[model samples]
Target chain A: MSLFTQSISPETLSVATLARIESQGGIDPFASPSHPPRVSAPSFRLPARAISAITLLALIALWWLAAQYKIVSPVFLPGPEAVFRKFITVARDGFVDATLFQHLLISLGRVFAALAATLLIGVPVGLLIGLSTVGRGVFDPLLEFLRPLPPLAYLPLVVIWFGIGEPSKVLVIGLAMLAPIALSTAAGVRAVNEERIRAARALGASRLRTVLHVTIPSALPQIFTGLRIALGAGWSTLVAAELVAATRGLGFMIQSAAQFLVTDVVLVGIFTIALVAFALEWAIRTLDRRLVPWSGRD
Target chain B: MSLLELDHVSVRYQNAVRDAVADASLRLSSGDFLVLTGRSGCGKTTLLNVAAGFVSPSSGMARVDGQPIAAPGADRAVVFQSDALFPWASVRENVAFALRMKGVPRRERDRRADALLARVKLSGFGDKPVWELSGGMRQRVGLARALAAEPRFLLMDEPLGALDALTRERMQTLLLDIWAESGTGILMVTHGIEEALLLGTEVIVMTPNPDTGQQGRITRRIPVSFGRRYRAGEPVRAIRADPAFAAARAELADAIFEGELQ
Candidate 1:
């Protein structure tokens, strides 16, 4: 009966009958549909992003509930409203001699500076390792030695060598970033399609030109992947980096607030760090889409 | 010497194995259409690679213009089975790659690239990315990119092996047209027996050893003239319709699978 209302059947399914059915306003002469066909949403589908958003909402609600009921001391886990108010206060009134924006800017500067350093040093070193057997022999062990060492593990060493200066903080962050960039670049270079190199060489590109035009361009996607990983590494290393006598940074602010038992300010600092990292990640993903749109399309 | 020659060439890899190619030889001259066909494991591609200067013969000679072919060069451009175009570039930029390497001026190279794109029947597609094109179109772009070098010989490793049958037939015609117009010698490797007969003035059936099935060598060189007939203004369909084309195709297929068991 439902099939008759819809007017799709073995008779109607034929091409010759399909035209006749289309000519008439009534899909079925015997029974008209209760309403016109509604294009309903696709069934049994939940967007992954919506799931994450819901989880975040739940966590925030749980935080609010715990704070409202006074299940934990205010010093430990403040209400979202209190943290939000503190965030506003810091954004406007400043915290521990520097405002929230100033601390964020300072940390951003360090991360960017470290990133630039990594690019300058890592790309060439990676190219050497990828292209030269001797370079692989020389640098492979050194990189492997350094790559797994936690930023905290090397903090004392950096401080001892560089004397707790701004360079020391940047250097520690750069060290954390270096291996990802260099290794990813090496992998990218090594994974370049052999046929592309041959095609370029046959087109009369010199060895140097081939590397410059073919190898580097082909590896751009992977290099960008490395940069994203480096950003995450450098961001995580920020707190450790600032522990070296830093006066103005989110890490320093968080530590200073923690010592004073200013839970709201500490929460503010942590939230800002996470928010900024999220923003930077989104920005990088957008830029990657724009620049290397051809990366995995084929 | 022919424009390109492989004389008694054999190639052995570094590790424990038989020679990948054992004692194979062939010649290609200007405007000549030569095809290498065989079953898999027969090293037909290895022979084409030697001719392209991508691989050197371990014991014998691979030469162009009587000069020992040492590395991949402009004289013998190669089209791979995989259309290995740079994704970072537009189609025009890819086609102009050879001219760019030669330090050709910007305007001149762009014009030449456009001309080559037209030759490959892909007009007005210069600004498109390689990934945006279909398989056959990408293959055509690869052909245009190679032809930009104006190579004396074109070596291909099953350039049409990836396309559907209809696209393959169209490309076969396009390849012949380019050969007739440019006078570039061609050496191609393919698994298609009819394709070899349809496109080759001369076809070499490379055979793997019956005993070991590892060492590959040339067993028969069958000369055909279908590509030449098409080049000389005969219609493609009519040429294929000829009784001789069918006879030659059967014979080529027999030669390719000769040493293998029934």
Candidate 2:
């Protein structure tokens, strides 16, 4: 039977069932509490290293088949071996007076700095708006107006304000990042259980203390959700910002290579972006796991 | 002197045409446990909120210890029917939340919280999150949280009404124990007539709203000492064997369901 249905009051029976499901005395169906239990007795599960080799072989076969048939032009879609050679050439020769490492580092630094700036401004503003009616009243109209305007839409203004320097790139990224974090924090704050707030007040908590202890803590799960969304936006905005003005970042490299019809190099840049985004998400998920272990049961 | 007094208290919501609670007056003195038994929406919870100072009465005085009650404070703790334990917090942290709000040191808070949990018979489950507990266990945590504050007045709104028959009975007994130990005057709201009789020093039978003015009152006080020592299983046997217990229970049930006797 489906766990949730509109017919049954989930609040009544499901809550009780969920409570029983989360109980500590019983082991999770999937995870064993004691001594790293196996989900299914391992049937010689291949390591990623082994799987990578198999994947490489499969790709090579597909590439060789395509090349042999000439269904696609070699110039447009290079074979796996040809791409590997290009990768080696780039690793050896470097591009635009900078190595791949330098390009990657510059992009990473820009994104990180932008994200940091977004967090510095967005979180506090979100909290202020979220916690008090006055703050929300003051800021919500402005935010609603701003939230819909694309981060790129503010490009000309930001360029005029800060110039096309690293700061401007960071500012653009931060602006893009801000909405998700601030909006999410506000949502999280609003969602904090009212009962907990009352309970805290009853315990003699001053207004400020209650916000700090009860409201923030209870809102944490939702706050992290907002952070993840903000990070994704920040990453996208960073790439867009880099493309517009930067001479040396990954986005610039891709744009420059595309102009020269160096498709292989452009592909590499795109792959690098995908890899970086994945890593950032992985790190955030790890942090979320540590911070909100209770979310795992659901 | 009255320990807590609501003099002609009235509350009307923004959208509602009539008052939710209108000119309701109640006086709860020291050592008195008042149970307000009525139908749902009979304004028992609203009255409790007015007493706790969460809801402002439109035009009446609500005073505790001769001081006017305004915003919610540690002086009047409430145990909600929903249990309302912070889902993010472990059982210990949930109980200790009030103490933490009171600026109790972490170690002291933990110690006091542990004792409170033990009082509710939730000793080993302190580290478990509120979500990890049974409905009854969560309610126990709510009870523990209210008790941890050591409030001057306790306001319980059908706190044990959400539980099963067995757990509800156990909690009623637990509540009596806590009340006796603390001597904090209680104003509980429950629908169960038997529960009101078992727990209250005075049972107030509130008539449904739109007909609210002065409604119901029963003043045959239950002797606090009668069932203090009896465990869960023993109470029914002993109480039923006593003829007076049956009579008082009948009287209370009648007062709640039927019209009050003046």
TM-score against truth, every candidate? 0.91, 0.82
Worst 10 residues of 2 chain A by lDDT: A1-10
Candidate 1 lDDT tens digits, A110-226: 999999999999988888889899989988888888877888998999899889999999999999888877877887799889999998998899899999999998878767767
Q: Candidate 2 residues B155-245, lDDT tens each?
A: 8888987889998888878887777777788899898877777777777766653345332223233343234334334565576567766
**TM-score of the candidate numbered 1?**
0.91
- All candidates: DockQ: 0.63, 0.41
lDDT by residue (B1-262, candidate 1, tens digit) is 2478789999987783799899988889997889998988899988888887788789999888789999889878889889899889999999999999999999999999999999898999999988999999999999999999989889899999999999999999999888888888899999888888888989998899888776899999998998888878899999989999889888888888896757
lDDT of 2: 0.75
Chain B vs. true chain B: TM-score for each candidate? 0.97, 0.87
The window of 10 residues in a row where model 2 chain B has the poorest summed lDDT is B213-222
